[model samples]
Target: MGDDAPAALVEIVRRWADDPSLLVQRAAVAAICEPRLLKAEGAAAVAVDLCGRCTLHLVGLPLAERAGSDARTLRQALGYAWSVAVAADPGPGLGAFRDLDTSDPDVGWIVKENLRKKRLARLL
Candidate 1:
């Protein structure tokens, strides 16, 4: 997967981000959240995009649908993943994070969790 073209890789990640399975979505976030991967040219933007898609997937699910262990796994992965992407590309990354509608409890929790990260605190 890492050897694929950047555009193709991003597309694949997008699909994973959109997948119904929370474990698959967690994999997508974990795949791109690596600091080394984010250092590659244009990788940060791709990470931010994919992360945003994953967040949307979470936010769109009904509250009842998010009660499973799979959802918790995805939420846990996202809790710290935003910091990596934001540190990699503050402009687009922060923009994407800030663009989320935090009124939704899940989105609010994700945003608050990212804000608590020291990495993001230092960036801010």
Candidate 2:
């Protein structure tokens, strides 16, 4: 069971690394599984991690199955949403996100600008 989860996750990540479309990225979310023997043993369930820090739990739907679904479309939409969130969120490790309006689809485009303005590489 434990082995299955890592294998599946690796497969998905490999697929994503090739082309790197939002569809494959979202579908590659990791799932953890455990054994359960009903009442006495209790029930074990599988969970997928969307982002390591965020922990967006994906409902069942495996990567293979999602390939046929509207996954690509959903993934694009989610990527856009993530960018928007990243832009608006004013938290640590996200100092690169401030000063952006959600209207722009390329919200992450500002990262380079931030780096340039701060003269980070120039310091080196």
Candidate 3:
């Protein structure tokens, strides 16, 4: 019973990682599983790619936040995931996330923060 929830949650994140129809569900589960899944086999790349591919303008962010996760956790997880994806393959990996719009205030803020990190890295 105790192990079942975590396993089930991970399974959900894996199963729906790239399912556009289920982006909200996938994001929710992924946000919750971000810490563990990032260390799981190939999970970080998959989640990062899915995050870029899915249209997460409305439901994804709110649902993820409401899923008992904090902003810092999500940001760290996403940044790590994106960094890993880019390191693995720059074109497809980085290109996937390039078109993300900075419209939603929260998403915009995150995108700006990520851009700032990248800019700072260039100077270093």
Please name the candidate that would achieve the greatest lDDT relative to the true structure. 1
**Clashes by residue pair, model 1:** none
RMSD values, in order shown: 1.9, 14.5, 7.2
Top of the candidates by TM-score = 1
Ranking, lDDT, top scorer first:
1, 3, 2
* Candidate 1 lDDT trough over 10 residues, lowest sum: 1-10
User: Of models 1 and 3, which has the larger TM-score?
Assistant: 1
Pairs with steric clashes in candidate 3? none
| Model 3 Cα lDDT, one tens digit per residue, 1-124 | 1133655655566556545444354354345334444454554465455556433523365655534544444444454344444444444545665666667554565455555555323422
- After superposing candidate 3 on the true structure, give the runs of residues whose Cα lies further than 4 Å from its correct spot: 1-13, 16-47, 53-72, 117-124
Output the worst ten-in-a-row residue range by lDDT, candidate 2: 37-46
TM-score (all chains, Cα) for each model: 0.89, 0.28, 0.45
True-structure lDDT of candidate 1? 0.84
Q: Model 2, range 5-124, lDDT digits (tens) per residue? A: 545544444454233344444443322112121111111111111222111221224647445545545434333333332322223214323333434333233333334433223322
lDDT of each: 0.84, 0.32, 0.49
In model 2, the runs with Cα more than 4 Å from the true position are 1-60, 92-124
lDDT per residue (tens digit) for residues 16-90 in model 1: 888889899999998888887777788888788878888888877888889888888898888889889999999
Query: What is the TM-score (0 to 1) of candidate 3?
Result: 0.45
